[model samples]
Target: MVDDLVPIFALMIPIVAILSALVVRPWLRLKERQMQASSAATAEKAAQYAAQTERLEQRVRVLERIITDRGIAVADEIDRLRDDRTTDPRPLN
Candidate 1:
């Protein structure tokens, strides 16, 4: 009975090892692929954010140029009027 069990145990060890190797090998490969895909997606989103930031920066520069051309004193007056509108507590009847 001991001899019979010894051969079965030896066979099972190799089989279990092979099965685990087979499963883990493919799982690792799939995980690597997922990582690569996620990295690409992240890079794409970063590029889009960079482009949006650049456009916003350009708009700010244009606004600054216009304000400077018009003069700070005039711009301040306009800002004061805008603030007045927001601060007015009176309801429009």
Candidate 2:
């Protein structure tokens, strides 16, 4: 009787595997989509951060140039800008 059951068990194994694949395929596809979306969002955020960093670096370079220049003219220019701001009568929107 055990020998007779061996063939039956062998046939059931493939059937069970097919049924499991049918049941799990959709779940696997959904997880793959989620991972793709997460990857895209991460890339977008990294690009935004890179752009922000570049802008900050540019500003830092400008400030360094101003500080490293050998002249009282830079101080005079900064003071003039400050005075201009106080004298401006335009209403800020």
Candidate 3:
């Protein structure tokens, strides 16, 4: 009986190897495609964030220039605008 069981066990090894090959290969391919799609979405989001950051940086640079140039006053101008609003409640044309 033991001698008969040896052949069965030996036969099962190749069968198991073939079954796993059929199953694992397709599963690996599916995972690879999923990873590629995820990476593409991430790259798109990164590009959008970079563009938004650049626009914000440009606005900040413009503000800094206005503040540094002699033509603009921060606090006094704000007060003047506030006074104008109170004196003339009408919207400018």
Candidate number achieving the greatest lDDT relative to the actual structure? 1
Cα lDDT of model 3 by residue, 1-93, tens digit? 999999999999999999989999899999999999999999999999999999999999998887788454776798898998889967788
Off by over 4 Å in 3: 90-93
Q: Would you give me the overall lDDT of model 1?
A: 0.94
RMSD of 1: 4.6
The sequence of per-residue lDDT tens digits that candidate 1 reaches over residues 6-63 is 9899999999999989998999999999999999999999999999999999999998
C-alpha lDDT (0 to 100) for residue 18 of candidate 3: 99
Candidate 3, residue 42: the lDDT equals: 100
> What's the lDDT for all of these models?
0.94, 0.93, 0.92
Q: What is the lDDT of residue 31 in candidate 1?
A: 100
* lDDT, residue 55, model 1: 100
- Tell me the TM-score of each prediction against the true structure: 0.63, 0.68, 0.80
Candidate 2 RMSD computed on C-alpha atoms after optimal superposition onto the true structure: 4.0
Clash counts for the predictions, in order: 0, 0, 0
1-93 in candidate 2: lDDT tens per residue?
Answer: 999999999999999999989988988999999999999999999999999999999999988887788458888888999999989999777
